[model samples]
Target: MEHKPLDQLRSVADVQPRPLSREERLQRWIDLLETDPKRRLSSLGEIEYKPPAERALLREDDSPLTVAYEDPVLRADGLSSDRLGDAMRYFALSDGQAHYALCSCLSGRTMEAGTCAQRLRNATGNVAWESAVGAWLLAALAVSLPGLVYLLS
Candidate 1:
C-alpha cells in the first residue's frame, strides 16, 4: 500500500525561530561586507573609476555590483576596541549619511539622506528598502561625479 504523505510534516510544538530583526539583518550585511576582502576594498578610497575608454569596452548590459559603504557606527558597535581602531581605518561612514545632505546642496536638488536611510532601515519589505537605498546612493554619486573625476585624474 502506498504510504499516505505525512499528515503533519512538523510537530505542532515545533516552532521556527523568528526571522532576524531589521537591525540584525543590517548588521549581518555589514559583517559580510567587512569580512570579505574584495568588499572591504570596494569602499570609497579604494575604488578606481573606470576610464571612459574602458567603460566603452564593456558590454552595455554589463553592470558592476555596487558596493555598500560601511557604516562607522555599526562597526564601532560591533567590534572590540582594539579591532575597532583598525577596522575604522578601513571603513567609511554610511554612504547615505555622508552624502545625504551634501548631494542635495551640490545638485540643487533636495532629498535628505538621513531620511532615506531611516526609511530604508524602517522599510517593512525588501523592495521598498532596496529602492530607497538605491535612490540615496545614486543621488550621492551623481552629486559627487565632478569631484570623483578630479580625484581620479
Candidate 2:
C-alpha cells in the first residue's frame, strides 16, 4: 500500500510559520496597500468607523474575545488611486489579535470595555495605527505595481 496519508501529514508538518521582525512587519503592511481583498473590505469598514471600545477592543465579560482590526482583502485599499482608499484599513474583532503593530505607533494604547478604545474619550493617538497602515499599503503598492496595472487598467 502507498503511504499517501503519511506523506500528506509530513507535508503539513513541513509548513512552518515565518517569523516577522518589526521592520519587516511595517514593510509588509505598506506592501499590502495595493492589493488584498481583506484589506479592501477593511478600508470600506473604516466608513463605518466606531470607537475602539465600541468597535475593536478585546472584551473581558467572559467572552474572552480580542476585538481588533482585521484586513481580510487581497488588495485592501478599497479602490485604486482613491485617496480614501489609501487612508487605511482596519476591522476590530476579538481573540488572538496577532496583527503587526509597532511600539511607537501603538504606544499608550489601552484596553477598555462598554465602548471602543478609539471612543474611550480618553483614547488618543499615541499609537500610529493609521500611519502603520499607510506604510504597509505603500510598500505593497511599490512591489505590486505591474499587477496593479493589470487590475485597475
- Please tell me which predicted candidate would have the highest lDDT against the true structure: 1
At residue 123, candidate 1 shows an lDDT of: 35
**Per-residue lDDT of 1-153 in model 1, one digit per residue for the tens?**
654334453443454445544456454434444344332121122112434344222221111112222444434444322221222223332434323212233323322333333333343236766888999999999999999999999
Output the worst ten-in-a-row residue range by lDDT, candidate 1: 58-67
What total of clashing residue pairs does each candidate reach? 0, 42
Candidate 2 residue lDDT tens string, 30-93? 4443232122121112223445443333222211011121333312322122222121222221
Tell me the TM-score of each prediction against the true structure. Answer: 0.23, 0.22
Task: Please give the CA lDDT of all the candidate structures.
Answer: 0.36, 0.32
Q: How many backbone clashes can be found in candidate 1?
A: 0
Per-residue error for 44 in candidate 2, Å, reads 8.6
lDDT of 1: 0.36
